[model samples]
Target: MKRAYGLGTRSVAVLLLSVSLAGCGLPRSGPSKSEILAGSVEKLGTTYIVPVDARVARAASKSPELGFSADFVTADVVGSDVIHPGDTLSLVIWENVDDGLLASKGVNATELQELQVDDAGFIFVPYAGRIRASGNTPETLRQAITDKLKEQTPDPQVLVSRAAGDGATVSVLGNTGAQGVFPIERPTRTLSSMLARAGGIAVDPETAQITVTRRGRTGSVWLKDLYRNPRMDIALRGGDVILVEKDTRTFTALGATGGQTRVDFDSPNMTAIEAIAKVGGLNTNLADPKGVFIMRDETPEIASAVLGQAGLRETQRVAYVLDLTQPDGIFNARDFIIRDGDTIYVTEAPYVQWQKTLSVLTGTASSANAITNAAGG
Candidate 1:
């Protein structure tokens, strides 16, 4: 009976040890890194895993919505600086003698008159009557006045100059040192010059964005890009509204990275590698070399093209994988442009999970053995 009791006690201890070991080896509650990567390709849902390569990078880089193009900063449709409504013009008429209609009785035989362009686009003159000045340059108006006065006087000399006009004016608003209507007095007034006149960008120029609204269409370009590409500093036009905005696009870094937080791009065209570097790179001790991922939400058209699928719903989420262990991954990362509101996740090494599980089991086993030995004593 004593031997049988001893055997029963040993069997209970063995069963407990077996259960503890089994618990240590049990599958983890969450999906593994491999499983997550696999799900990216299987079309299990809206999530996709696209492998980064030269071909993939080239394709992805073609997205027009990702970055601003120099094409948008097109040549300013050059227009003559003609007079517009709500303009005040100063007119000077020099008559041959003091008997002309424009000549004052005793004021040096010359007429100095200030006239404003009416809402009907006409400016009143003594001999020219109500002449259309809205679409005419000062020189053209001067010639028109001379022609009109020719009927009354021989070779009447007239001068037309803009006192106050909207012809050379532009509206500058938002993050600028000065926000108001600025006149393009110089013939070579470009975007940069106008911005300087407006007291430059109020925010950090490196992270600033300038939006140019011409006519009814609006386009944006990064301030840094404008500085780098002189051509992008297109000539400014009348009625152009320039808005200086602070950089708002940002990406979040998660998992095993040096720092996990939201990172802002200094420019609109930031690459995946640049983003990683901005956050102090990956956490070498915990990061898996094979599991660098950029998670993004894509439009249906882009998602379909990327996943090679048809008839997918709009706004699909995808994970782009980059294996830093591969030789070409570095180059691909340089080419992979990071868009606004993207999440970069660096997965943990596979061994890290196993090691954690093993450590917990070892601690539990040691505690159980200590209790058992004490009981036996």
Candidate 2:
């Protein structure tokens, strides 16, 4: 009985040892309370922190004009509507009408006159002559032609058609794969369609802004606005010009990260997490969790003065710092977003710089030894 009892005791001890080792090998079930709190704090600091472009944000958020819903369409197409430049007009004469009566029967407008309206908004016709074609839709232009023909012949038949030209042409230029004029064939041209025509705004889209300049209109449309609301996909009228402005958002990043990098945000509303991913994720062994800063202009005083009249305050102008070290802080790291023109920097732990220097030295020494041996041979 004594030996049996001793064996039982040893068996229990062995089982306890196995359990201890298992705990060491298995992953933790969840983060501790402190980690959760840290993550929450970090996330709160990041989401509200935007870049220094209040002017741009304000401009983008402004309410669009009422009754001008980009989606809205009217059934009645008018004269001031039809055949503008950039519109393709199709002209068809009645088969019953003798060719003697219609001077230009069976002749295509494009073949005859290129069907282009000059900057002065007039298209040269064979008989109708240089008539003001701007703001007139096909039906209205046809009616105008009918009225003109009435003076020469009684009960004249006339047909006006919109061919491929004189509709809407948007110019996509600068850093685009295909930099040229893209004709907006449809009545309403969305921002997405325009980019497609321009070979999709170059690769990565970081350094691109679609600038829309109307021929006679004074104001231009911001490409970023389309991001906020697809409705900002403004309709393209005749002689509209589009510019794919080059990328301007750029910043330098350094410290415990994999490598110092220069990144581009292109435009606004690219969050912190996004910017970090662009430069490569944090170096697990080298990154120090506590140090991250987005550098911006120290122009709060200027911003406040400008906004003071408009009832904006200084408390609104501040950048954010994100801490990643504490396990709980990971939540904030994920939630905190960045905006356009914002820079993200992650600091490396003190030991990483020394390790990197040693790595370089070792590589150099190995190369030197290899070269010396090769020369001896």
The best candidate by TM-score is 1
Q: Lowest summed-lDDT stretch of 10 residues in model 2?
A: 70-79
lDDT of 2 by residue, 11-98 (tens): 5555455445543343332222233335432466422233223342332222222222322222122223355654545555442334
The list of candidate 2 runs beyond 4 A from truth reads 1-81, 84-134, 147-155, 162-168, 175-177, 187-190, 197-201, 205-208, 215-228, 245-247, 266-287, 298-321, 339-377
Estimate, for each residue in 180-230, the C-alpha lDDT of model 1 and write its tens digit.
Answer: 997766543788888998888899877888888877767787787788877
Cα distance off (Å), candidate 2, residue 63: 18
Lowest-sum lDDT 10-residue window in model 1? 63-72
> Alpha carbon lDDT of residue 10, candidate 2?
58
Mark the regions of model 1 whose C-alpha exceeds 4 Å error after superposition.
1-31, 38-45, 65-80, 95-106, 109-114, 149-157, 164-168, 224-237, 309-313, 373-377
Best by lDDT: 1
TM-score of 1: 0.79
